[model samples]
Target: MHDFLVDLLICPKCYGELDWQIEQRSLNHIEKGEARCQVCHTSYPVQDGIGYFLLPDSGREDLWQEVDSHLVQHLQQNPEIEKRLMGVPLETLSPADQFFRAMVHEEREEFELAEESQSVANSGIYTDAYLSCWQSQTKYLMDRLASNDKPLIDLASGRGYLVEKLAQNHDFPIVATDFSPKVMRRNRRWFEYLGISDRVSLLAFDATKMPFKDASLEIMTSNLGLPNIKGPSELLHELRRVLAGRFMSITHFYPVDDNQNRELLRQANLETMLVRDLASAAFEQSGLQVEFTNICLSLAEPTPVGVVLEGAGIDALPVAETNLEWCLLEAQQSSKAKH
Candidate 1:
């Protein structure tokens, strides 16, 4: 991580200022160090150029872990399956199979191949409208990102798709944050391979309790990350506390009348983060004025989870097929914002 980042950070656990002691540095990047909070005495480590700032008691569920674990075990037991699958042309594979193929590419550090596999899988699965809007949304973020020279932190930067695009397309510093250390490590290698490591840094931190100093950040962005955060009741408040500028997020909402998916979203207790009106209200309750803009509706069908072995497909959540309204969330401090 950059030395400049130390000034922007505080202890996420206690919000106390930290004392950074660097043990190793490569010019501007600190590859090894410990950032200890002066008040609470919580020591966070900087490893492999990514700062580990997650809370000790973080109870977040990692869907990636499940997939990786099952895939690893499946490949070990059925050794020939990997060769058989890899030998097939990517075009002939099902979207579900393509998804697993991408996983394999990722393991081998074949970044471009993994992305190619993902593109094929996504094209086969999601509706045309879904792909169009996703492309447009990414383009929109890339355009907006060019205006700011200051650093940007992409929250919940799983798999690093949005962040990669931003880094490649824009001329701004980016700090990609996720709760998963494994994801961060993967991103470090991937970004290095892409030759964009200098412009990007990695941090493993929970979004609800960010490591940023209070009101110190000018901009924060996320691509479809908001609704996935656990315990968002306090999250909005926490975001407002730390942001002096704005938080721009790309999110999609399922129709409340879409009985199958709507009930599923509500049961997950993510109504405030998904439903447009509910999201706005929740932001206002947290003392941030919010607006939903650039809205577009798209239809999405369920994507089949492919098997690594017989009957052991990656069982991921939210397989609901339905229509969705994609939009950008603009949230900033309100004049009426209460401390």
Candidate 2:
């Protein structure tokens, strides 16, 4: 467990700080310790290294018993299959390992996509057009925030497409960051291509743990990134923690389907304003006060049925022209909150 996670724990009876004691030699069993509240004289027992802060007679035992049964069943499953399927070393796996594995898988897929795009760029076929498309998209977003004069932070800023575009029009410093080093190198190339290598700084940073002081940045934005994140709430909290002026995130807004996604939004508790109700709910969510929201419709020819079927490997029918709706959201972070 992280040292910061200790902030989440408190005495259940007296709501005071309970001393963390390591009873066993193993780190996994360190939670097994008797906790006595200094204020209320209430003692909580530790069973199997899990501290039960609730009273012994409390009705919460049924919930904990169900959780314990589920864990036992999970442990009974095949270790090798669990390792291959979940990318976890089942024997040493803890709750933190499970969360980290999920994030690793998500990042692996994103890196694969970035590699494919780089391959296409190196093919020398439509390279100019591909780069132009990225440049245009970046410009479109930057133009909307023309009035803001603060430094910009691009979260999950793969290849620095947005950063380079902003550099072309504005002189403000740009911090381009991504979890993958491959993407950060791509971003460096973008700066070199734009002749603004000195203006943009690239860093490998996890969005959940932003490396910035509180209220250090004026603007924060992410394009086609947040949806791929597993810990959206943590990312949002970090964004709010570092942003000094405004926070903006552009993402593919899919409807909540599972408990994980539901819990993510619940933890963030962000005040969201949707631009336009698209078929797929493509909208931007901002923690700041939304000043404007607009929708832009673009038309493109659909992919061929054979290519679609081969790529997705699911279903194929017919190809037709379709309209795609993109949302543009602008908001300002309130100065009142230091979060």
Candidate 3:
């Protein structure tokens, strides 16, 4: 974690300021340390320059745990280059996608052992959608926000693509927060590998209960992560509580036209609508004004599941266009609460 960002962190349980104790440091990077909440006396560990301001358990256990375990094992074997990517095995892609693919590769065995076997399909979709969305808009969003001098936080940063980009291109302080330690660990390594660890800070914290004081953050962002969250309303409220400047996000929205698309939305707890409807509802709920909104077709091709349309032949499969809808929303503080 960066030395300056330590002042902005608070205890999620009591909302009190955190007192950080540094055990190891390299310039601005705190390689090993601990953060103790002054009010509640709860202590959170800082590992590999990333602070984990999260609960003992976030109740999420699955392929990620397996992936982290595997990575930890690999790191143990190659301690010399653990912080650097010199010894890590990754495929050819953007650094973020390479880390993601590495995680998926490491977790395959444990994924097969799971009772439901959803990880296989979910991981593929996740990789495709995130790569597509990032390639499509994340850099553009960062470019728009880069001119601002205020501190920026990337909420639910899946693989820290924006974080890396912003850190490399700008001098302003940047922080990346995610609920998964495994993902953040990869992010820390990536930063180290790219020689930008001093420019970025990583934290593991729940989105619903971020460890920041009210209005402490100037800008917040998330790319293709809001829909996976269970409660959009609560998240928006939390964003409003912590963000004093702007909140921008890129989400995958599907237009519920066909039965297959509708079913997909139902399973994901999503609704189909125009890009404006989604942006308006989100901004209204968060008490933020919609400053900008952009809609575009998804770059990933939809994989057909071979379901026949209602009016088609009995043996025919419905040829539906991809339900993937890519949307961008830029919102800022509003005086009046629309909801």
The C-alpha TM-scores of every prediction are: 0.93, 0.46, 0.72
- Candidate 2, residues 1-339, lDDT tens digits: the string is 112223334454445556555465243223245556567666655434233444434332331232222322443465653444354243333323333333333333444433333343232322343334434556667776787776577777775556666778887666676765445544555465558765565554466665455566767787756654555556656665566676665532323332443344345542122112321122224354443334444442322211111222111111233333345445455444425
Would you list the clashing residue pairs of candidate 2?
none
What stretches of model 1 exceed 4 Å from their correct place?
59-68, 307-320
- Please provide, for model 3 over 177-290, each residue's C-alpha lDDT reduced to its tens digit, 9 standing for 90 to 100: 888887887777667667887778888888988888888887888876676566767777788888878788776555545567556555656542223466477767668776
Q: What lDDT would candidate 3 get against the real structure?
A: 0.65
Q: lDDT of candidate 1?
A: 0.82
List per-candidate RMSD values in Å: 2.7, 14.8, 9.5
Clash count of each predicted structure:
0, 0, 0
Instruction: Find the candidate with the highest TM-score and give its number.
Output: 1
Measure candidate 1: CA RMSD.
2.7
Off by over 4 Å in 3: 60-136, 256-258, 272-279, 303-320, 337-339
Q: lDDT of each prediction vs. the true structure?
A: 0.82, 0.47, 0.65
Error of 1 at 250 (Å): 0.8
Q: After superposition, how far is residue 256 of candidate 3 from its true place, in Å?
A: 4.2
Tell me the deviation in Å of residue 21 in model 1. Answer: 0.6
Q: Kindly give the stretch of ten consecutive residues in candidate 1 with the minimal lDDT sum.
A: 308-317
Could you tell me which 10 consecutive residues in candidate 2 have the lowest summed lDDT? Answer: 308-317
